[model samples]
Each structure stands twice: as structure tokens, then as C-alpha cells.
Target: MNKKVVVVTGAGGVLCSTLAQAFAKEGHLVAVLDLNQEAAVNVANAIVGAGGTAMGVMANVLEKDSLEAARKTIHSTFGPCDILVNGAGGNHPLGTTSKPYLEPQDLNSTVDGFKSFFDLDSAGIQFTFNLNFIGTLLPTQVFARDMVNREGCSILNISSMNAFTPLTKIPAYSGAKAAVSNFTQWLAVHFSKVGIRVNALAPGFFLTEQNRALLTEPDGSLTQRGQTIIDQTPMGKFGSPEDLVSTTLWLSGEGASFITGIVVPVDGGFSAFSGV
Candidate 1:
């Protein structure tokens, strides 16, 4: 395959950082994009040290102006983007409920910091929605414009297992991810004529900085929620970041030329099990 310019949003995060490195290793000119400029720079520097071409860029997927600026930088630095990995997404604490379910008594009860489902803040829900769903949409608008009719051009969306079925106590995240998966299919069909393949990866539980506290105790043992996830997962463990690398590369390369509009699960059988 010819060398291509790859852009990865949220490249500073654990999963995306690993992905950025993997793409760089494949001899692609990587544009490491993140809201956190420092983290993005670090990842890019590491890639450069390891003999990969990369440049850290600060961008906000929510804002078109920011993305446009990033586009100029990327185009001038490494030509138009051939691959875009929409990886900038995470859940918010305020969008989560203190308990998994709601009861009549809980609605009237007033406890400090205890939020029932009814207490879910609209702003929090909107923030989560915009972060995952709109975030993915806006970046595609800005970047995919350049990718149109470009050979080997493709998009990889970062979906979650929650996209398949709602997870407990995190309705906002689940809904947002579902939107992402839905949008992935929509984009695949929409861009098919233009030669941009769109697909998503609905990853199972992987302990990252965003969900570290929720999945593990302070002592590093699995939390109750984490254990529950493990029990449901036939593999009985969290996936390593590296585990996702091969599939990501496959979808980005010509090997998956005929594949599009599918959400591949890297969840280690989590999606296949029915909890029976």
C-alpha cells in the first residue's frame, strides 16, 4: 500500500494513543489530534522518536472553526487526509445515575450527591450527546471533504458495546454511542459513491483513564461493575489496547476494500453472550 496521511482524533487517550502508534508503525504520516494539546504532542513525539511521521494538533470536534484550522495545518503539513479515526468521545459523571434503576421512594428522597434517573441534568445529557455523536459528525464533515474520491480513503468510528444494548446507569453514553453506530451506517451509504468506506468498532470493556475509577478499586482490583462485565464476557478479562490494532489496520487498508457499514466488535465475546 502507498503511504497515506492518517488523522486520529482523541489520539491522546489510552486506546487512541495505541491506535495512533500502530498507524504510524504502518508507515503512515499521522496527524495526532486531541483536545489536550500536551498529550497529543507527547504521542506525536514518541511516534517521531520511534521513526514514524507524526504531528500533534489541537482540535475540538464540536467546533467547525477549530476543525477547519486543523484541516489547514494537516493539509499543509502532510497533504489531505486519507484516513480519519473519529476517536474523541467519553461519558460524563453528571449524566450517570447514582443507582441503576429508579423507584417511587427514590424520586422524593433528597440525599447529597445522589442523583436518580429523574434527576439527570439536561445539560449533562446534552454534553454527552454532543461529545460522542455530534463530535463524530462534525469531524467527518471537515475531514471527509478532503477524502472524497481519494484512493484508500476511509473512516473509522469508535463506538462502544453500549451501542448494541444500553448499559446500566449510563443511559446518556449508551444512547450517544448508538447514535454513532447509526451514523456510521448512514455515512457508509452516503459516502459510498465517493469512495470513502465508513465503519465502526464497538469495543467492550477496556479500563481507560475515563472509566478507570468505575471499573477498578483504588487498590487496582476489579470493582463490582467491572466484575459484572467480566462475568458476562466469555473471555473473562479486559482487552488490551494492542488487541484492537490489527482490526483497525485491516479496515484502514485495502484488505477491507469491500467492507463497509459494519460495526466490528473487539469485545472478546461480550456482545455474543446473552448472560445465560
Candidate 2:
């Protein structure tokens, strides 16, 4: 079989690393992209050490020029991208609200504890929007072009649970991921005639660095917030990085040739449950 070339952005990240490894295991040439050059290289090196073809490239999601350069470098090393994973998005603290609800004290108290919606900084909002929405958009522009006439070519975006329902304290992230899901549909339609599939993965409540504070206590036990999340989820547990691999592989391979424009949730039924 001809080897496919897959590009996974934020390859140093836990989920992306797992996807990259899965692609390599299938004998595909993998490009590990990350803002952190060292970590991306580390993942690529591990793949190479395992006798797989891999290369690391640093590309900032917010920067078009960096993505262009990375695309060129990847082309020189691994040919065109068969599978593109937009996995570089996350939240900024400034874009977050302090609490879930609007309390009466929030109106009177001048304390910094609650960053009201009215006080959301413009830069903060822009940063989150740029990171999650624009970040995914720009990379698709840079990489998916090569997928136009190719078989088994697809784009997988990393969306959030907040996209399905608004999560509190993160209006920017929620809106941005909502945009991401909408854009996935848009791209899928736009690219459908050309054989390029666009889809997204909405992961629910993983204990990654993005949500570590909410999930784990200082001593590493589950926090109250974590327990609350588990109780709300039908599966009553968080997902492991490994849990995402099967879907990732299926989406990237010929098995999912007819599937496109869908955001698959690997959230242990968190999105399906209603806290009942």
C-alpha cells in the first residue's frame, strides 16, 4: 500500500501525540507540528526510533507565514498531507469569567474575583477567537489545499464540549469552538466535490493542562468540580488519550471515506447526558 502523509498540529500535546503515533503505526509518514519545536521533534524522533517515517516542524497557529514555511518543509520531507489535524487550539485565562452565574454581589463588589462579561477585555476575546477559530482555519488553508485531488485525504479539527452547549466562565472559548463546528460544516461542503473531507472531534472534560485546575486537586486527587463532571457524564469517568485513537484512525483512513462534516464526541457521554 502507498504510505499516506499525515500532519498533526500540536503533536507534542497528549491527544495529538497519540494520533501521530497511531498514524505511524499504520505506516504513514507523519509530520508533527507544534509551537514548541523541541516537543514536536521529540514525538517525531520517537516515531523514527520505532522505524516509522516522521518529521517535526514548528508552526504557530496564529501566524500565516509560519504555517506556510512549515507546509513547505513538510512537502520537502513527507510529500503532500493526506490527513490534516488542526490540534493547536486552547483557551486563554483572560477570556474566562471568574464564575458561572451572575450573582447580586457581582454588581456591587469591585473585587477582581469575578470578571464580569462587561469587563471582558477586547484583546482577551480576540486572543481566544484567534487561537481556536482562526488557528484551525489558517492551518486548513495552508495544508488542505494539497488534499484537493487526493484519496484518503481529510481534515480533522479539535473542537470542544462547549461547542454543543455553552459552558460557563468561558464565553470566548465556547463561541470560538462553536465557530469551529460551524466552519467544519462549511469546509466539508466546500471541499466535498474535491474529495477532501472535513470533520471535528469534540472531546469532553479531559484532564489535560487546559482543564487540570478544574479536574485535579493540588495533591492530585479529584476535585469537587471533577466529581461534579463525572456525575454529570453518563460514563462517570474521564477519557484517556488512548480512547481517542480508534476514532482518529478511522477518520483518517479509507474506512470513513463517506463520512464528512461531522464532529464526533469522545466525551464518555458527557454531551449526551442532561445531568438527570
Candidate 3:
């Protein structure tokens, strides 16, 4: 590697921060990008203190103008981008149903606890889609221009386990992530000759801050839902932030040059085993 400039969106998130740190350690000029300006700057400062070249940029993935500004700043400072990590994505509660399956008795009953598919707010659904789908698309539009006609350039999109198979309750997220996987393949084919490698990472069941409430109870124990998930997982444990490093590093490096348009699941056999 010739110290290529690498940009990681959502650098404030746990998974993305780790990837940013890994790139920093490898001596690449890192651009830590996030919706939160201060958080992104903090990650960049941490990298700088550890003897790496880095710049912090604030960007809203859904907004084209803001992303364009971010690209200009990074281009001027670190030259063109060689690696792009599309890590800025998440789900919304409004887009989620309270139960996995709808019950007829629950429809007319005004229960404070249950929400049906009809209760899904359109704004939340649109927001989730814009965040995960359009969010991934626009960032690529802004940053990938630098990768065009260049050698050793790649883009990594973050997909979820639900992408391969939809999970319960989060229909919007599942659909959006599925689109991400499909888009990864579509973009890979479109940009093959332009020298940009497009791929995705489907991470499964990490109890990050984003989904901690859904996975665990307030008393610091696994909730019923969490237990069910653990039982289903062949590994019988949740993944740690470090668990994904190997796959991420390999996909970002020259070792994966021939690989593109594939979604590599970093799950503990979650996508492979069907409990039989």
C-alpha cells in the first residue's frame, strides 16, 4: 500500500471507529467522517495523537450538497480517496412493529404495548430507507469519483444479517439492507472497468449502543428476545467489535482484489447454519 487516503463514514459508530483505527494503524491517511462533527473530529484527533495522518469531516449522507463539501475538503487535504467505507446507517423505532406476527384479537384492542404493520409511520419508513439505501448511494456518488480510473480503489457498504433474510419487526430496515446488498452487486458491475471494487459486509448480532436496548434488558441481562437469538446462534455468544477486523482488513486490502459484488457475512455462522 502506498499510503492511500481512506474515508470512513459514520466514524463515530463503534464498528466504523474500529475500522478507522485499523486503517490509521496501517499508516493510511484517514478521513473520519460522521454526521456529528465533534465526534468525527474526536476520532481524527485520537488517530493524530497515535501518529497517523487524519482529517475529520461532517457529512449528512442524505444531503447531496453536504456530501459534496465533504468530498472537496478530503480531496484537497488528502488527495484522492482509495478506500471508502459506507458505514453511516441505522434503523428507526417508528419503522418497526412491536411484534413479529400480527394477531386478530390485537387489532381492535387498544393495547399500549403492541403495534401492527398498519402502525408503521411513513416518515420513519422513508427515513430508514433514505438512511440505509440512499445514504449508501449518495456517499458513493460523492467519494467514488476519486476512485475512478485509479488502481487499488474500493468501496465497502455495511449490510445487516436481515439483508440476506428479513428479521422480525424491522421490515423497513430489512428491505433497505437488502437493497444495499443488491446495490453492491449492481454498482460492482457498473464500475468494474472504472477500477472501483464494490462489496458489502453483513454483520450479525453485535450488541452495540444502537441496538442494546432491543437485545438486553435495563437490569443488564439478556432479554427474552436476546436469549432466543443466542440459542439460534451456533456460537452461542454475541460478537465483539474486534471480531470483524480480519474480514474488514482483508476486504479493504490487495488480498481481495479479485473479490467484488459479494456480501461477506461476519456473523458467527448465522447466515450459514439453519439450526439443523
Candidate 4:
């Protein structure tokens, strides 16, 4: 495979950092972008230390100006991006309900921290939407220009299993990811004439820093919610960040040249199980 210029947003996080390293290992020039400058620098430095070509860039996916600045830096350092991965997204506590179902008495209860669907914060919901959907959009706008009409270039989005089915608590995240899936299809069609392939990876139940507290106890044991996921997943385990690497590479590489507008699940059969 020819060495390509690959840019991965959210590289400071667990999944995207793994992705950045994997791309670099494959002999691609990588730009590790994140809102957190320190985290981005750390991941990029690690890749460079491992004998890969990489540079860290600070970028806020939500802000067009920040994304444009990062794009300029990446273009100057790595040439035009041949592959782009939009991975900056997560759930917000404020957008999540404390419980799955709404109950009659719960609505009238005076519990201090009780949050139902009705109690979901509008600001939190907006934040989730902006972070996931708008974040993906702005970055794509700023960087995809380099990919337009460029042969063998592609855009890979980080969607979630929540896009297929709404999770119990995180309605906002679920909806935002759904929009991402929809946008992926739309972009695939819109950019087809420009030679840009668009696709997404819908990951399931991965143990990352973002969800570690909700899934595992401090003692390294599974939490109740984690146990529920395990019971539901056919694999009976949470996925590691590395599980996504192979599929990610395939989707962004020549192997899947004909593929576009699809959201492939790397879910360990979690989406396939029906509790039978």
C-alpha cells in the first residue's frame, strides 16, 4: 500500500489514539488531532518514538475556525490528507437519564439527583448533538477539501451501535450518532462525483476512559450495567480499542475501494443478539 497522509481527530482519546498509532505503523504520515493539546502531543510523540511519521495538532471539532487552523497545519506538515477519520464524540451526563424508564411516582418524588427523560437538560442535548453531528460536519468541511477529486482518498466516521438502536440512558448520544450514520450516506452520494468515499464504523461496548466508570467498578469488576451488556453480547465481553484497527484500516484502504455509505459494526455480536 502506498503511504498516505492520514488525519485522525480525537486522537487524545482511547479509541482514536489507537487508530492514530495503527495508521502510523502502516507507514502513513499521521496527524493526531484533539481538543486537548497535551493529549494530542502525547499520542503523536509516541507514534514518532515508534519510528512513525506523526505530528500532534490541537483542534476543536465543533469550531470551524479551529478545524480550519488544524487543517492548515496538517496540510503544511503531511501534504493533503488522503484519509480522514472523524472520531471526536461522546455522551454527556446531563443528556442522560438516571433510569431507562419513566415511572409515575418518580415524577412527583423529591429525590435530589433523580433524572428522568423529562429531566434531560436541553443544553446537554444540544451539546451532545453539536459535539457528535456538528463536530463531524465541521471537520469534514475543513479537511475534505483536500480529498475532493483525489484518487484513493476516503472519509471514515466513528458512529456507534446506538445509531442502530437507542441505548437506555443516553438518548442524546444515540440520536446524534444516528444523524452521523445518515450524514455518512448523504455524504457518500454527494461526494461520489468528487471521488471521495464516505463510510462509518459503528462500534459497540468498548471499555474506554469515557465509559469506564459506568461499565466497571473501581475494583476492576463489572458494574451492573456492564454485566447487562455482557449478558446481551454474544461474545460475553467488552471490546478492546485494538479490535477496531483492522476494520478501520480495511475501510480506509484500497481493499474497500468500492464500498461507501455503509456503517460496519465492530460489536462482537452485540447488535446481533436478541436475548433468546
The residue-by-residue lDDT of candidate 1 on 1-276, one tens digit each, is: 599999999999999999999999999999999999999999999999999999999999999999999999999989999999999999988899988778888978879889898888989999999999999999999999998987889999999999998999999999999999999999999999999999999889898989999999999999889999999999999999999999999998999999999999999999999999
**What would the per-residue lDDT of candidate 4 be over residues 1-276, giving only the tens digit for each residue?**
699999999999999999999999999999999999999999999999999999999999998999888988888877999999999999889999888788898788688877888888999999999999999999899889998888999999999999999989999999999999999999999999999999999999999989999999999999999999999999988899999999999999999999999999999999999889
- Candidate 4 residue 149 Cα shift, in angstroms, is 0.9
TM-score of each: 0.98, 0.96, 0.97, 0.98
RMSD each, Å? 0.8, 1.3, 1.1, 0.8
Stretches > 4 Å off in candidate 1: none
**Candidate 3 clashes between residue pairs 3 or more apart in a chain or in different chains:** none
Pairs with steric clashes in candidate 1:
none
Q: Which model scores highest in lDDT?
A: 1
Q: Of models 1 and 2, which has the larger lDDT? A: 1
Off by over 4 Å in 2: 110-113
lDDT of 3 by residue, 1-276 (tens): 579899999998888888898899988999999999999999999989999889999999999999999988998899888999999999999899988998887678687856799888999999999999999999999899989999999999999999989999999999999999999999999999998999899998998898999889999899888998888888989998788778888888899999999999988888887867
Give the alpha-carbon lDDT of every model.
0.95, 0.89, 0.92, 0.94
TM-score: model 1 vs. ground truth: 0.98
Lowest lDDT 10-residue stretch of candidate 4: 105-114
Residue-level error in angstroms, candidate 1, position 202: 0.6
